[model samples]
Target: MSDKAPKPLNLLDYHRPKRLRLKDARIPPLNAESKRCLRNLTAYRPSRPKFPYPQTRSAAVLVALFVGRMGDLYVLLNRRSATLRTYAGDTSLPGGKWDPEDRTIEDTARREAFEEIGLPRDKLKVPLLCILEPFLAARNLIVTPVIVLILDNTLRFPFSLTHSPLFSPPLPRFPTEPELIEVPYHTTNEWTYPGPNDTTLTTRAHRFLTGREAGGIKPVFGLTAAILIHAASIAHARQPDFEVELAPPEGQSREERIAWAIYSSPVFHEAYEAEEIKVDWAKVAKTAGGKGGGRSTRR
Candidate 1:
C-alpha cells in the first residue's frame, strides 16, 4: 500500500521456516567415497626402526613423474653442479637428504625439487605412486625414492647454471617412440669402481644404450640405476605401448665426459677417455662456456 508495490514480497517471507532450511540441504554419510579415499591416501607409516647410525648418514630420493596427454611419461633428472661437494656434475634425480622440518619423505622430495630446480612442488598434482626400499650407495648414505606425478602444465620452473637442463616443452608429446621409453639396467656390482685418489670413495656408472647401438654414459649406476630400472618397469606395465630394446654400451656425451673428468680423479678420467666411446671435450667445454641464458642447449 505504500506505493512501492508492497516491496516485492521478500523471497524469505512467504516460505515456511522448515521449507527454507530444506531448499538445498542433503546430508552425506560418514563412510562416503571421498572420506575413504582421503583416509587410504593419508595413512602413511614409516618402517625404519630407530638405530644408532648417525643422523647425518641418511638421505632421500624422489622420482618426479610427468605424464603427457598421449600417456608419454618421463622422469626428471638433474646434473649436479660442479661446485657441489658431493656427487658433483653427476646425473641423478632431483632429491636430497631430509630435514627436521620435513613432515615426511614426500615433503623432502618436494622441498629438494624447489631448492635445486626452482620449481614450486605445490603446483604438482602429486599422488603417491609407490615407495622403493631404502638402499645404500658407495657413498655410505641411505636413500629412499618416492614416486609422484606432475599433472599441471601451467607451472614454470627456473634453472640455474649449476643444475642440468630441464626437459623443456614438457617431455616430447605422448606416444613417444618405443625406443625412447626403454631404459636398460645392469648389476651394481659390475659397475661400482673406486675413484682415482681415494680408495674409500667409489662411483658407479650406468650405461644407457639406445636401439641404434648409440647411447650416453650415465654415471648413476647402483641405487640410482636400480631406481630407474624399477620406474621404467612400472611405466611399461601401465603403458603397453612403451617398449625398449636392450643394446650394448655405446658412447658418452662430451658434457658427461667433462663431468667425469671433474668428479673422477685423473685415473678414472683417463680410463673413461680411453674407452671405445669417443667424446668431443673441446666442443663440450665450448657449449658449457656460453654466456647467453634462458635457452636450452639440447637439440
Candidate 2:
C-alpha cells in the first residue's frame, strides 16, 4: 500500500452516473440481474435516525455487491484479523469510525474498504448504488450502511492476507433458503437497563447463527447480521424467511429506544460535547420521548 493518500473523490463522481454517454455503451455492460439489483437499491428511501447531539460516534460500513458466477448478486465480506482485540476473527463488512478528514460518510466507507482490502477508491471501479438508513449499534455508535457495486467481477487486487472475500448466498435466495444460516435462524434476548426513577427499560437483542467454519472464522451475528438482513431485503425486494420483530410486542421502536439511550446518557453527552460539536436539544427531546433502555450490554 502506498503512503500517499487516495485522491479525494470529486463531487462529480460522488454517485453513479445517471445515464451513460451512449445507450449502446458496453464499457463492460452489466447483466440484467445486476442492473435489477442496482435499480432496487437506488430507489430505496431508508428512514434516518435523529439525535440532539452531533453524531461523533458515527461509522460507515460498505456493502459491496457484485454478480456471482450464477448471475446473482453477492455481498463481499471480510474476516477480521485475529490480532485485533475486539471482534477479532469475526466476519464483518469492511468499515470503521468516521475520520475528521472524511468529506462525507460515503468517503469513510470507501476509504475503509481501500485500506482493508486494497479496493480502488475510483468510482469507475466500484460505483455507489445507495446508502441505507442508520442503524444503532450496541456500542452507541450510529452505523450507516453504504452500498456499492463492483463493476468488473473479474478484477483482482492485492488484498490483505486477512481479507477473505466470502460470497454470501445469492441475493434472491438469501436467508429464505440460505445453506449458510442455522436452522432456527435468529433468536432474541431481552436486556434490562436502569432508567430514570429506578425504572427498568428493556431492549431486545437479535442474534443469527452462521454455521461453523474450519478456518476459525466466527459466525456472523449482532449488528453485522442485522445490516446484511436489511441490505438483502432491500436488494431482493422481500423480507427475511424468519420473523424479525423483537419483543415485547408493545415495546418502544428501536430508533425511539436508541434515541432515549443517547439522550439520557450523561457519559455519552459529555464525550460528544467534549468534541465541541453543537447539540440540538429540541430534536433530541422530540425523538427520545419515551423512557427506555439507555444502552445494550452486548454488541
Residue 264 in candidate 1, Cα distance off native in Å: 26
Pick the TM-score winner.
2
Q: What does candidate 1's lDDT look like per residue over 1-299, in tens digits?
A: 22221111111111111211111322123233323322332232234321111223345677775544443455666667768887766567777775655555566667887788765665224445555545454454546666655545565666744745554222222244444544542222332333222322233344432232233324454456656654554444332233322221222322232233333334423332333223344433333332222312111
**Total residue pair clashes for candidate 2:** 0
| Clash totals, every prediction | 0, 0
For candidate 1, the lDDT comes to 0.44
Candidate 1 residue spans exceeding 4 A from truth: 1-55, 160-163, 168-205, 209-220, 235-299
How would you encode candidate 2's per-residue C-alpha lDDT over 168-229 as one tens digit per residue?
A: 53343345434545465456676677644445666655565544455565666677777877
Q: List the residue pairs that clash in candidate 1.
A: none
Which has the greatest lDDT? 2
Per-model CA lDDT versus the true structure: 0.44, 0.64
Model 2, TM vs. native = 0.76
Instruction: Report how far off residue 188 is in candidate 1 (Å).
Output: 7.1
